[model samples]
Target: MFASVFVIALGLCYCSRASSQSSLGLPRLFGPSEALVKTAIEMNCELLTFPEDEPILLQLFREGNHSRLFAEYTSLEGEVADLPVYVQPYHEGNLECVARAQNNSLIEPTVSNIHYLKVIEPVKGAEIEVRSGSVDLFEGNMLELRCKLKAGNHVSYKWLLNGRLVSQSLLHDDRLLINRTTSQDSGSYRCVASNSFNQTDFFTSNSTEVVITVREPVKGAEIEVRSGSVDLFEGNMLELRCKLKAGNHVSYKWLLNGQLVSQSLLHDDRLLINRTTSQDSGSYRCVASNSFNQTDFFTSNSTEVVITVREPVKGAEIEVRSGSVDLFEGNMLELRCKLKAGNHVSYKWLLNGQLVSQSLLHDDRLLINRTTSQDSGSYRCVASNSFNQTDFFTSNSTEVVITVRDLVSTPNISFTVLKEDFQNYSAVVTCRSTRGTPPVTFSLYNSTEVIASVTVEEQFATFKVPLILGQDLGFLQCQARNGDNATYSEKIPLEVVPVGGPVKMPYTYDSGENYDVIGVTFYCKAEKGTHPRYQWFLNGTLLDDRGSFYYVDHQPPEMAMLMLSVGDSSAGTYHCEVSDSFDNTTAISSRRLYLDKHTLNRLPVWVVAVVFGSFTFLILLVSVCCGLGVVFRRRHYGEKSLLDFEMERMTPVYYGKLDLSHYNEDTDVVNAARWGEVDQASLDSVDEWPQIEEEKKTLEDEPAEEP
Candidate 1:
């Protein structure tokens, strides 16, 4: 080993490129080779201490700490460099160690030819880790295991599977890299790092073994959405089951168009839609995951379950895709039907409220192959479909106007200067036709008549108009006429901002309530003309700049801020006048400041008296009505009781009277008259009337006749 290392070091000693600065003394001991020194010294990176009494094997190593950059390194003299040599810690099998010759310039550093080798050994830690392989493995997967410590001189690596020496030709090196691992490799694996000081003396480290398990791939993973629903109309419930034929150790998730379904929409292995709406129409999928035999979670998705939720088509909106009502003749046009929240199956096209052929409605878009002037009418789109096979739904219709122009392409309009002035202001509106067939005429029109016209053979035309006599011009238009196909662009309102006028600033309009005391400031600006003046007056009296309660502050650019503490005396009409010294013209605007006065419950005598009198009258009327009602009720009940008693007494007495049914006609009539006419007041008097004389005479005279 020493002879081969010496030969390799000699072969690698030649310096590749000369350094910009003079290098140190001849590449000697205690440092790297001449090639490595040439690269490292220019980069200003220090050289680490070499192991004493060992052959210069030039081992390439990496810091085991997994960070963005392993920025820590120790030199022979315990020095460090700012620019660290970067290395990948995870990929460890074969690495190319390159030394970059860096300088203090911003340019890229020149890199040296990289020397390659296997990663050095790790330190003796008490555990085993997968340095270059996954922690968990499956059948038919390649795996590599590494010892935590690298082998030194007289050191060796031995791998054991469940405490038994694994016998394989591929385990010659210190690495335990395996390809297509199977269940035979699944055991308690540990790396036995043995160090030998002499031929007879050796030692081994106590490393905790790592267990590896392998599982077979799932068989035929799929999902099925079984539905028993037919009446899937609005307000109806929809039921579906996400059936899977995967392993039992799988976790399920319901996804609606790649988005995880909300908790309310998922119930265990089923998707239960409580109420179906128009928005629920989409593709659904079932995703499952299994992590038993893998390092990270592995997932599989089922096929999409397409569903259509239906509702009544209530309304629709029409959108002209070309964004123009007036289209050039012999051009393609498109109109879209923006349907409301509904599930529609078919559509019908209409022209001027009359139904057109169903063939005209194509792809939710009404495409006019070649529009002509005859097709200039109101076009309507009627969407018709049913929520279900058995139920019927109302169709929605929307209309828009489409005027197919017979004379030109739409013109491009722009104004050079759009400004208004009471004096003289000239502006121009230019019309350009870059795509139209030219020999076109451009016309600028006001509200009523065409005011300016220009015929141009070129692709552009301009029309100049005066803003005098009327600064308020209506919407201006430009028409480009070519042959019999002329069309004007959309109307452009020529809004000219006023150049100079009486200055106006936004102000507050708040009405003060009673008992409110506030200090408000009013501002008047006059920057229109030179040498302007500002004045403020309250109720026809000029307020002087006297006290703190009433003061005026003059500011830059011709503005005055009048501050006033408004109270009862300050509540009056105020006017602010601004005058232009150059034009001798003044503009005045007035505002009223009124603070309501507080009153202490003052009411009119007549109103109070009328209210009190009305209340008293209402009380008396209610009391009298209650008393009369009670008295009337009592009298009515008393009379009813007397009548009932009289009827009951007469019933018994009449039955005890003589038998009047056997009487003759004359006698019956006479007896009935006598009985009915008998006075109720004389009934008690008849028994006591002249009783003594009649009884005595009857007894003596009729003694013989009695036998």
Candidate 2:
């Protein structure tokens, strides 16, 4: 019993030892997988397999070379190894831990798994660029700013305006675009570039700030005279200023009598005259303008100001009938010379420094019944006293440039497509009027809505517009207007060509071949675009239009089909080239396999399921039939054996005869007789029965045996 007990204890000890050995897990090196260049990082090697406090050796293997890395022990419990510092290039490699002995010798040099450390470059030296070429722009123009970097990898960018984050709607990958810019958009812009390292920390750098200044178009200019009175005496100083309601970076110029005054006498926005004489008593105006746009300057002219000097004929100003010198053909023209403080004044007109005829002059006015282009010239009015013919004191008003322009004829409209890119399709529409004057206002229209309008000094005007792919061309129109007369050009009849996108050629099994395949149909479609045309290529060879083995069917706009015969050498990599009718953008479909004629026919899923189900049911039915037959046969054989045994051991019984004629064939013999007849007498006379029987037998024995 003691020996048995000892054997049982030994068995328990062996089992416990095996359980502890399986429970201990192997040590692993764990830390971040990535690090930035020139940065130091740490890694830990813990959960050591060996249960000892011996020192560990950390090693790195990189570029077919192995080197020992610096590691130290941690203060925490169960400390294994801690990497002291990780330098780039030298320390970036596969890292592992080796168990060491007390004498600094390797205990086990083999490692289970290795952890890779990848070094990534940091983001640096980011800069911003104004793609629109200038940081200063006018209102209602496009503003595009792009971000650039000197060196970066896997970088993303964000924009800030005046120390606030910009909206995502105006930002693209590295660009920011503001359409129809406003004055509120003027601010200092900055770009921030960032990238991720170690999958947890981020490195970012800021770009230099770019300042933007948005100016408004000059409008509603008025001239203000700073002098005490407009009617200045001779030798009095004159001060005239130009003020703007809305404008920026404005410069002013003084216009005296419809002629430019020298800039030498202008001071900023003010015009100064040290001494004023009767010659300065004419229409005085100021023109306010700014060069804030890349193409043109926005200019505005203030209303005419009549300055009068203390004289007999003062403030001689010319006034046209319509407050404008511009007139249309076959229109009445009138010019009147007026004075601010004068009496008995008679007016005379001069064209191009020449005196006008008396037939066109009337008292203090000049009239023309019908004007023509011949009437265009610089005209001025001279006011004089009628009473003094011998000593005529005359004063000339400012020169007025009268122009009689012909009515604007029907404008001709035409367009040229600038670009056909899918995202930014654009066109330039030109509107021209050969019979009209310069500085004509041209308006471009789509249906009834005006797309854009411009007033150019030349006879033709051009408008840049974004084009939609499927819009009707008849809706594009242009109009030229001068004064109150306007004329529209004929509607455009040309359509915008559709841009083509990526092509996808997907082949599907339509029908199965019985003996020989007719063909296989491949459908090619564009992911997004319009008016795509397709061409088929087999093994890098373009298919002919009248090929005997292939046929092309164009479905128009977006889809096309190619049918290739299966029996020919058409079993190569097949692809389709889709091109846009509007541009040179062409896309090729990915190469796909073409099945041969000898390929096995793929049956439908439902047919295969039906065949499998029928076979399974047939097997089940046969199994049930065989089992029933065996059971029935076994029962029949067992019953036959029992019956034969019973017949082998038979017993016979005798009965007395009674009423045999009344017996029924269907009834048993025992049940057919009545026992109460002569059965008892026959039974009691059994002793004499042998003699009677012997006598009866002797009487019938000879006949019964011999017969």
Candidate 3:
């Protein structure tokens, strides 16, 4: 019995130990099978194999595969190994499996919580750019691509063309070079930097493009002429174009048939000869080159142009028909240009040698109205036919010297108003020719006779006279005379009047009578004058120009009133004044004006309207609410039985109670008739009517008030 007990006790102890080792509840395989141990290690299981059994035992590794990114796994050793402070163990053939978190990406479990292992997937942030030495791309240019602003280990650069892999670095390099670019190389390119652990799991940069254009190298070039209708006429405009259609870095030159023309005389592939005459008839062509490449150009000469000239006009000379004359500044002169011999001729006038006027009066005459000293020049008239417009020809005209001598201008009269009023004012008059000869004589005259006279070698003269203010001013003027001519000024009209303004109103604001409320009523007055202005003063201080309560007058400005709308603050002793700067004078009121404060604050129209409207609305709302309350309670009482409705004690319980105890079926008709208040109509012909019992409705204390 003792031996059997011992065996049973031993089996129980062995079972407990085995259960603790088999964490996944699987039976532990105690055999050291090589295949099982290798497979478990490959799947990232933490295996505790004997040092002599492991290949070298110098390093401990979590289960993983070897790759180009193996170097990066070392940098995560400390972080991943420090986590998942617990492990579950199992036996797999020759190895024991210890399962724990192999990466740092995990929620740390509490002591009472079940722990878990989470594997972190590798990720990288990447960007790309062109290499610094790479300029804008062109054919035959060297180009490079670089991966920049990236974070990852074991990163490899890949360049794609049109979404397909084109250029790749040999090692873990981040740059790719293109030896030379061709037109066929132009494409949408993309550079990608990857962690290399997973190629498809990558970030792609923005697309960078390469544009390649072909520029042909320079060779020999030729010139061509494309002038249509070069059969030359005297006035025909011609052109010769030297063209080089094929070459890089090309240059051009122009030539006259076989003569090499200086480049200084030509403007880029053109040679222009204006007003071509008999001397201009020649063979013309241009020479072309690619001087930028230092290459001489070739020319095909069958395209030469020979020009022939002709004359369609005869004897186009100009003659001066009018002799020159000396004249005063204000005097007029006419100069004429006559065509000596030409058909269908036109005329132009010249001062010295420069062309002056192309449009002229009838008979080619130039009129100088109010001629000035600047008009004194050598005048000539030019005669030309239409044929001479484009063909070169010498314009012929004899010069004429226009001698403008000792010129006198019209007189201008200015005045200063002196004292005196009513009908006339004492004033001084200045008469002068603004531009004239020095020895000028000015005579001041009225309609009847000359009032004053002065002869001075200066530009102006003055005289004093008592002038009338009205119609007589139009009768005075001045006349000025030089050696050759005399001139009279337009009449001078003098306006003279005494300055005036309002002195006082017949009534004063001091009157105790309440005549008007603020600006509601006002006294009307029209301040009439020539250019009248006004100023107002209140309480010995100038008021601001305008304010909220000031009156707006639809009438003219001078006919408006000065308003005191709300007079409490505005009321004061006031003065009215005006000043005229024409004669530098001022006018003030003869007597003082006064305003007094009213008994109450004047309400604006809008405020009064708002107050009245609100009171009316509130009265209407209260009346509507009270009437509606009675109507609704009566309706509710009629819909319910005498005892069905609930009522508070303070409210009369009898108010909603319908007294139906005395009701009878036959009395319905009689009740309706009495309730309708029917009046009896006379039935004269009828003798007997149906005898009906009347319903009596006695007023008992006007009934109890309802609701």
Candidate 4:
């Protein structure tokens, strides 16, 4: 091992382009062969000292850490410890540390094994050198970039094109090689040199950039949309760029449907169409070319990319597949929305102006598995597309009314007797259904035979038929049908009532002693009858006038009542005549009703006169009291004097009733001041007054009674 290491070191020294500096006194060094720059390193020799002997005069030395030749650096005496070696531009040379004896001829100087010091400096000053003077490259030519360093050691090279590390296949020891290059290889190229001084952290340096322009015939050309998609809608902006996989200094031309588009429609290499319309939709491509000479150019056509421009949806209308507005219960319903013009449309259903069930909104046609009454409503459809993310381009279909009806429910039958003869009876039979559509047909059945049928817009239908007495209107049934379903009422039997009786009055009539009775009810009924009619007679005359005199409340198959409002002439004979409406047979009451006279008491003339006179005297007395009270109130509570009251009493000036010419205004004011009862302004405020002396004469003619 020692001999081989020595031989290897000697060969390395010879192989080095630059010579290494060595310390002549030091022997072969024994230490680590590799180290970091500016980091301490140790070199020692195998020299020892005994307790009984003097320490050997050993020292350490280092060289070849600098670029200068024959440059040697040494350590102090007895400095046989670890020798730290610092590096400069030059590194990776030999280091020697020698140990010698104090005094002994037999003990020669000790020499250590060769210590090869390899100082790894941080990489710096990295620059890429293009082998070709100018990087104006052509297709099918080789690309070469040499990474050089101004000051670094043990560095590895990496090539980056456009700031990305190049493939390892093109890297060869501080150089990048690309043979038969294409336009894709043309970009800013840089070389990175890196080395680790401590094997833990790597120091890296990037080279100056070099750009290569590789010109070639345009190939693998294509058009790309700036929005990453070629689909567009009306009013949308379209921007398409021509891209070439292998080309340089190329000009672009756009083509639509194999037709060359004008250059005015293009912006540089891009074709821009603002507010794209349906007319702009077609197969689009681009041709790329480069002119090498004034008249020579290489051209290539790109692959076509079909573009689709959609039109906004509009004028939506709903159509019912069943072709009818009304639908039966449990029927399948289908409705579709049709558009006037649109593309790529999606539809949704709205029922009664609200969005329908989410589980049914999957397609243009709304399909129902089974329809019910709950599904009856106004139906509409909305059409939209991806053109409007906010649904502004959406349209609503015109409303289509849909009516889902239920099957006709069980019919209900009833009978009402209109009239009847001695043998045949006329009756109205009605049939109805609670749940059904209108325009229902109802049939009346007697013993499984149709007696009558009637169709009406209402849910119910009525039929009038004649029945024979003592015969079966047998098992009367009513069937109601509306559209697809029919329902029947339960079978019923009809019975005929005959007129048999000695008719009698069951209830009593009371007119009592009260002369002022509002009404008196007289009731009469037969022993047995069918729909009996009654007539009331007063003094042998039929009381047909149902005016204020009487009201006849009669219920067939029951009793008939006569309510008489007592009037001056309502006192006389009263009787009820009962007759069967079915047979025209009549019967009279068993006994007649005699109503006593309800006469009002008469008053004497003298008594009426006394009452009238007493009322008039009382009214006059009250009026006189009211006037006197008002005068007293004005004299006390009001701000008026007694003279003012006297003046008011004497004044009667309307239509010149009072003759005020005999009175003087001045005499009135003098009298007011002398009395001290009225102010002059109060006396003057009175418009007129009766003659005072004449009024005094009239008062004197009246008798003066006690106060």
Pick the TM-score winner.
Answer: 4
lDDT of 4 by residue, 237-321 (tens): 5789888777778888888998988777798889988557798899998988886444667898878888887665458898788
For candidate 4, the 10 contiguous residues with the lowest summed lDDT are 673-682
Model 2 reaches what TM-score against the true structure?
A: 0.32
Worst 10 residues of 1 by lDDT: 651-660
Report the Cα RMSD per candidate.
Answer: 52.6, 35.5, 32.2, 52.3
TM-score of each: 0.20, 0.32, 0.32, 0.35
Candidate with more favorable, higher TM-score: 2 or 4: 4
Across 102-190, the per-residue lDDT of candidate 2 in tens digits comes to: 22243544342577777677788888988888888889889999888887666888999999999999999889999888888999999
Error of 2 at 437 (Å): 68
lDDT of 4: 0.65
Clashing pairs in 1: 121-150, 122-149, 122-150, 406-484, 406-485, 407-485, 407-486, 408-485, 408-486, 408-487
Q: Write the per-residue lDDT of candidate 3 for residues 1-707, one digit (tens) a residue.
A: 43444433432222111112211111111221222111221212222321110111011222232121111111111112111111112211122222222222231211111112222123245545666353334346666666664343434567777787874442237665666666455556666665422234443344345432323333333343333444444433345555544433335555565777656556566555433456556776654544311333333333456666554333433433444466656567777665545656567677776777545355567776666777778886656555435553234466777766666778888776654654445767888787876788888887657999888989789888885543245466888987757788878655544446454433212222333333322223324333234455666765455666554232323433456564546555555454332343655443444433322222334766898798667656655665665566557568664223322111211111112333334554443211111112211111211211111112222354332
Q: What are the lDDT scores of the predictions, listed in order?
A: 0.53, 0.67, 0.46, 0.65
Q: Show model 4 residue runs off by greater than 4 Å.
A: 1-311, 315-325, 330-378, 385-391, 405-412, 415-439, 447-466, 471-473, 490-492, 508-518, 566-569, 582-590, 597-707
- Point out where model 3 deviates above 4 Å: 1-321, 325-395, 398-443, 451-475, 478-495, 501-576, 582-585, 589-614, 617-621, 624-707
